[model samples]
Target: MNQQNVRNFSIIAHIDHGKSTLADKLILKTGALEQRVFKDQYLDNMDLERERGITIKAQTVRLPYRSQKGDAYTFNMIDTPGHVDFSYEVSRSLAACEGVLLLIDASQGIQAQTIANVNLAMAGNLTIIPVINKVDLPSADPDMVREQLEDILQIDSTEAILASAKQGIGVEEIMEAIVERIPPPEGDPDQPLKALLFDAWYDLYKGVMILVRVVDGHLKEGMTIQMMATGHTFEVEELGAFTPVPKRIDRLSAGEVGFVIAGIKKLDETKIGDTVTEFKNNCDKPLPGYKDVKPMVFSGLYPIDGDQYENLRDALKKLRLNDASFTYEPETSAALGFGFRCGFLGLLHMEIVRERLEREYNVDLLTTAPTVVFHLKPEHGDMVVIDNPSNLKKQDRTDTILEPYLRGTIIVPDEYVGVVMNLARDRRGIQLKMEYLTPKTVMLQYALPFSEIVFDFFDHLKSSTKGYASFDYEFLDFRASDLVKLDILFNGETVDALSMIVHRDKAYYRGRELVKKLKEQIPRQMFEVAIQASIGGKVIARESVKALRKNVLAKCYGGDITRKRKLLEKQKAGKKRMKQIGKVEIPQEAFLAVLRTDVK
Candidate 1:
């Protein structure tokens, strides 16, 4: 195949804008999939992605297409994750292509991610062919969507195509547009090998399988490869490209996308952003590595059964092999026992990882409330980065504390603007600006503390907006904050996993609400269990769960109300002695029952 006949592109879009579906139609039209096996979202074969109707990972398929002009072309289309959590991942996928099909839902119009990704594509200097997907739906307004696209992106809307990916309309037109509009990858195949490793996964039989885009030179089977990032060399056991499935080839040349199989034992060694080339004939300088995806949130994952701690460790290890954005370290909580402190890209990333562990690894995990990493500087010592709240147990009062902040952009229906403003203010968000996208839709910008959004901001945003809002954010910088640690105690014993760092103004009320929720979740023990929320050793709120023996008024009636009150007073006085000797058995679920909240 000639390099001139090759076209590399990626499908960029907001969530559920028909990226995977369009990819499916293109693959089928190209005859990459036989009619007997064609299916929607065939590239999103994972059970989780199929069930959720979203693409969680980046995937690529090689298609051999013949243009209407009768010229054969080799098309490599990369499918990228659509959520904000994986925006950086999407960038890596886009980096593999010379251009992209900017897919948008015609009915939903342009979204937050659509705006962000358009900027990203411009930054990369990639050609963008706007695509209006879901045109088959009755609600689709191609003309309106086109106007919005031109207004927001300043792109000529006349070039945008209207199509229904699900109904297989405009498949040929899009394919032809890709070949005619997108330029072929530019690089000399004779140069020293330099392939950008964009994605990877762990394989039980083959070890690490790295997905790469060959920008220059060639990679073939049984060759020694060097990872520029890790400075490690490996003997390639296999080399191939995806025809929606791995297909062995003699070699992957420049302007091609494929996989390099080697005996990679540790995933960190084959980092996604690294450049892979021949060990002996390596290029003098590796390709510019990608901007690593920094984790925006942190949490603790403790096993429901203490004995499964090792299993949980193995599960995380496996999950990280495929997901480069996740990071973790060994951490311990007095209340939850042995567990690991994990970092995630966002709340959705945290949820997906938790779900995967439970469904795929078959291990029940109790995740502590999510938090953003905090910077703590002592009065006379080096600064420290803390992710777990329990680490603040020994911090100094005079030390300066800094919290991460983010610039959040939200697009919402105009009707929900009031509720959104309230939510933003409650979360310590400062309005930066507001603008109307359409008469029925508006966009807002805010400077919000990352800690506030890390926990469950998206959930609340959707809740307040009636699920008619889309949000995206970028890290601004860390700034000084008046923050304090809120601790929860059961029977006067501190529960480390239940501790969290919050702003001073919110501590008292948040503490009060926390203990109340815990009181409902924590089961009564052999003796009366007293739950307290405190900060700096001062208890702010308290709740008590009486023991079985305290229920002496089981036969209470309206006529016996006075007697019931007397018994309750007696039980309360007697609880003083019982509380001193009682140990509250907080159930596993109690450790995370109310973690759904954005704060402690």
Candidate 2:
């Protein structure tokens, strides 16, 4: 086979822009998998990926196709994560590819995330292949999309592929274009082995699977490869790319993208973006990759049933195998009981993980409101990272606490501009940049404290604009702001985990709303619970939920001794699940209600 004939590329797109579906069609058109073998996004092997309709991790597949000139060549198709949260993963994937198939949703034209991703791809110097996906949608305007790309992205749109991935239309042309347009890998195969670790994950059947792009190397079965990041080395037991169904053996040489499975047992050993070189003639210099990603959003995840804590831990570990962006630790909460101190790249990433944990792992959990880490400087000594509201204890000091802020951007119709400005002002948003996207559309930028947005601000933004506003935000480090530590008291005792820092002006409003939501979500319990939000010793907001008058061994259904004992056991279990929020042992739903606070 001619090595120069092969083309290695990845499909890049924003969320729900049909990147995965296009990969499925490419698999079908190339006859990579047997007829009917592929369902959708066959490259995304994780069940969570399928359920979420978003590619959470990067995956690669190999397909053999005949180009327009009637020549057979192999195309390595990599599907990358589409969200901003996994930008690190996406960048690493791009590093291994020579070209990218940029999928833009036709109706949406160009979005905030789409622009950001395209810029990253261009920065990587990959061959840009513009593709207008979902062309068959009623609202699709490919011409407008092309104009946007040409004008904003400064890329030629004459070669844009207008096709509907869901309908498998124009997919053959896409495969042919891959061979004709994208250049083949270039490197000296005889040189010391040097491959870029784009992504990695643990597989139960194959142990550790490391996906690499050979920059200047040749890898074969039985050869030893060293992971330079962690200084661990392993022998390559097998190497190949999936033909969308079964793994096929092929020598991975310079410029080609493929997977190498060494009998390694854990994901920790195969760090993403690490360099892999043959152990015998290992490359002297490590591969240059992006800086390690640090999660900005922090929250707590608790099992609905405390007994599932172990199961939750195992589920999280399994999830972390494929998701390097997630950071978590086991923690105990007075309000939420026992759960995890989870870290996320952003709010979207946090929501996606929570949804996946529920849908994929079948673990019902209660999550706290997402928060940005605050730098709390003690009066006497070092700075402490405060992620949990419960971790913010009342300490007597003249110390300074710096709160995280965010640079928020929103695009909305010009008609709702005033409403949006008013909303932002209420949330302590300081206007920054404003631009006109189109004659009727305007983009507004604001610098807002993270504390203000954590409490149903997104909902308020949407509701105020009647869902016409779309926004994105980036963390802007910590700054001194007018912040107050709002403590939640249940039964006159403070729940350390339930305390949070909020903007002084907005604290009372948020407190009242949160307690109200909690009152509605929390079930009646053994005793009345008073949910109080306080600053220092002053109560700012309060909500009182009536105690359960009808829960204690309500039914002794049978006279049988065994049946009566069973009823007692059930009652004990129920009582164990109830949490004392203030003076009330509230059910788990109330804790979750706080996370879904509806800003009125």
Candidate 3:
């Protein structure tokens, strides 16, 4: 059978560029989804994805349809994460396909992320089919974006497809281009089973479901399969392609994309981008191309309700089953109680996962401000995971510690270029590359120490750019620099969670801002609560707010026994929520509230 009839393609675009919306239109046009009830970004199944108007994880769906010429083809439509944090996820998604439908917002033109997506597509050696989406918008400029892509990516602009994914316009042409341009899977069908596990999920009823792109032979129900990476084998029970909804099939053949539910039940067993084959008679060599996703940004995720620890653990396990990049482990804090130390691909990825856990699982969590992992060495030659800034006990020795650095890129309007450059220098960011996207926009590259840009950098960038700047970063190893551990003291007692690693030069400025933000977020207690940032015994900054000592007794409700007792009980519960810092019992919001702003 000829494989040319199949088209394996993924949609790539910047966040809010209508990539998800475009995917939905394709799903509707191909009859994969009902046309009458078709909604926007319908392929993003998670609640967080819908709420954020972004795709945090990659998803695949099969849209089987006939072309205008009456030629039948199976379009394995895939969607990728839009943020740079999930760059690895994007790469894996691209690897599983032969072509990408590059969706560019007609109004926004080409952003920083659009270029990143195009670079990944070129690296994968996939054919690029540029689509100018959101044509219905008043600011739509398809021709302008087409020229930009052509000049930047060096690809032909004449083939660009202009469409409004919202109204389902020009979707057919995009699909037709995929069929005409993307080369079909080219491998021997009779060879032993060799499939790539680009992504997988665990269903409550179906066990471990592995999403595989078959390269050779076929996978059938009841056939035993082996994961070469883990040396684990399981019997296939269910197999089918996701239609964005579950659709069961008896078997999946070579060059086809579908999921396999082997009696495998655990996530750790089925590795992402790993190889799978028929057990006993499996392929002699494992399938090529498998790379693990590395975590760039990390933070501690603690349960707000300490009693719900088990619920939190189960929630994380469930989340991990579907997401290979999200990692966590049980951890405890002297201040925030018990929680898990979670690792993420990036900040946005961390935010999406946290949001999903709260919304989908109904689990409320207290996430410690996001932190990047840093490499540190001591005189004893001990290696430690320095996740929290407070964990670092600063000594008089300067060369004893090493901190993380980030290779960052910022793309902004050309007018505010000087302001951004000055701000970067203030934050200890070193300029590396400057490229003119057009006469109006310039992309600035920087090599900044992670400690300098970890906090408030995102907000400062936007402020400098007047909201026209977008930034992305990757951790580029550790370097020794003048650094210090700044501690936050509440009511003369140091709050362990609020301490952070900062540069020695900017300690006073950071201390003041952090203390101020902490004071604002943390509510008053029975005794006066004083928020202070200190280096060793010296107080660098301080903010004090008097506590409400008479809150409970003053607001006494004179009622029947039931109502009166309930009021007392509520007061006691409220008191319990407050964490005692020195002489004051501060509310939990103080710890959580400071995370909302940039601490300025």
Judging by TM-score against the true structure, name the best candidate.
1
List, residue by residue over 36-90, the lDDT tens digit for candidate 1: 9777789987899988888888889999999999999999999888999888778
Candidate 1: residue 211 lDDT (0-100)? 90
Models sorted by TM-score, best on top? 1, 3, 2
Local accuracy of candidate 2 as per-residue lDDT tens digits, 1-600: 477888889888877888888888888777777665556667777676777677877778888888778888988888888777777678877887889999998987777667777888888888988899988899888988888887778889999998899998778778877888899888888899999887666676988777788888798998988988888889888887767654757588888777788898865677766888888788989888657677888988999898899889978987776677789998987666788999988777888889878877889987776777888887788999888766777745586778887888787889999999998887778999998776666788999877677657777888888976777777777887656788878767886666777777778887888788877766676656777888887898888877555544556654778876776687666654564332445565655565675543
User: Which structure is stronger by TM-score: 2 or 3?
Assistant: 3
lDDT of 2 at 263: 93
Name the TM-score of candidate 3.
0.89
lDDT of each: 0.86, 0.79, 0.79
**Stretches of candidate 1 exceeding 4 Å from the true structure:** 394-397, 550-583, 596-600
Per-residue error at 563 for model 2, in Å?
Answer: 33
TM-score of each: 0.92, 0.87, 0.89
How far out, in Å, is residue 204 in model 2? Answer: 2.7
lDDT of 3 by residue, 47-140 (tens): 7777767787888998887978998999888888888877777888887888999988898788878888888899889999998899999989
RMSD of each: 4.1, 5.8, 5.6
List runs of model 3 lying over 4 Å from the truth.
Answer: 379-385, 396-398, 547-584, 593-600
Pairs in clash, predicted candidate 3: 522-590
Comparing 1 with 3 on lDDT, the higher-scoring candidate is 1
